[model samples]
Target: MQTIGLPGTAAPHARKPGLWGWLLLAPMVLWLLLFVVVPTGILAVYSFCQRDDLGRVVFSFTWDNYVRVFDPIYLNILGRSVAYAGLTTIICVAVGYPVGWYIARRPAGLRNLLLLLVMIPFWTSFLIRTYAWIAILKNEGLLNGLLLSAGAITAPLELLYTPVAVVIGLVYAYLPFMILPVYGSAEKVDNALVEAAHDLGAGPVRAFSEVIIPLTLPGIAAGVLLVFVPAIGMFAITDLMGGARVPMIGNVIQNQFFKARNWPFGAALGVVFTLMFVFTYLAVQWHGRRSQR
Candidate 1:
């Protein structure tokens, strides 16, 4: 029997979107230009200019602020911030990956509930949550009391006002971001591909390394950028938990703005910080595309 092609069987040709699409996107373009683009332009202009003692901008262009930014003290702080963010990203990936995988494999009805639980903390103010950490980590706080009762320590352990607490706060705050993207990728993974690898005599470790890891890499890259970048710029947790003892880059930029009354220096730091983020984003994208290929 001869058969005719149906409309449903015809291949659709892709066409360039018309001007209507650009018209629809105009509002978003204008918003971005007005808010993000304009502010960044102003900041870039300020970065090259000198500031007066009263913190007013002077139009005279100078590179003194940029030179000061490379001084050892600020460089050391920037290095420390990178280290902290690196550690946070590592921890978040290690912890979030398994949880995301498990959640993604769960029944559809349960996955939403689990995700909601993860997001519930965001309903409260982040500052309030950070403050609560103070009460929990203090000398006479719940941790110390529990340790004392358990005879783990003869005296109250100094848990608060330390680098550990700062790390804890950062990981706690950003973990959900790492998980959500990984879960999204994991959910889309094909079960048959894993089964095929196993059937081909691949062991668990080999199967993961050869098949699963490659597929979920997009999520891992997204999660790493999500957790690492913001962690580097976080100052509040460092201040509240680390007692402002060891300053991060974020603290220095903040000091320049408010305490040091050096707007030019702050603007320079802001520009540099933003550039770092852009580099990180590009690096992540490059890695993701390479892994996919």
Candidate 2:
């Protein structure tokens, strides 16, 4: 009689994807090639070319566009963008982690309701939501009125068109991105393992630190990836809230393409931005693998 493999022994080898599987993947692969790869190729080609006085792409090779990206003014903007994104990521983790954990630990019915509430903001148009923040942060807006009524201050604070307003908009928009991923990870943690740690004389803090955090790390990394990358490149939030006072790299890229009519420089900036995304992804993946090891 043939014996079944034990848990420690290797199981039967799985079959590779066949013709039907390839057929299923064909649409997605084609879509990626058309939308992602082709566009990136075009952008890279443009980045190496020049622009004429008439704002036309000149099919000639030059490294000036990339060199210009390293100019002091642009470098400062890049630094500022990184700083803002880093701050937003930190705030999201601090606030979202607890909320996600709480919701995940709740009763089934309540958990669904809380998740719905967290996701409701996405139902509305992003532009409309950002405009709503302008009304709240303006001098004569809801926030100032509330502060005045509460006798918090005599004069209205200049909250709008500032770094603080920009940060608030960023945090408000991206907090849900952080929360959902964390909730997904936190929900899967086996309660028995936590209990076992406690039974072994681990304190609440110790158990949570040593067990819960590690278990939820993948979600946190995913959340950071989701939040940090887009946050760095977001132009709308910074524009409406910051009123041109705080310009991120996204704003620079947009202006290069539209306002300045400098496609080559814009493409260079875009290529750099894409590289940053790749680096962030690889770093997150590396960290996750290290934690697993």
lDDT of 2 by residue, 21-56 (tens): 889999999999999999999999999999999899
- Tens digits of per-residue lDDT for model 1, 1-293: 01244546344633454799779999999999999999999999999998886888899989998998899989899999999999999999999999999999999889999989989999999999999999899999988999999999999988799989988999998999899999989998889989999999999999999988888888898899999999999999999999999899999999988998888889999999999999999988887777666
Off by over 4 Å in 1: 1-14
lDDT of 2 at 174: 97
The lDDT per prediction is 0.91, 0.94
Candidate 1 residue 172 C-alpha distance from true site, Å? 0.7
Which consecutive 10 residues in model 1 have the weakest lDDT in total? 1-10
Candidate 2 lands at a TM-score of 0.95
CA RMSD (A), model 2: 3.7
RMSD values, in order shown: 4.8, 3.7
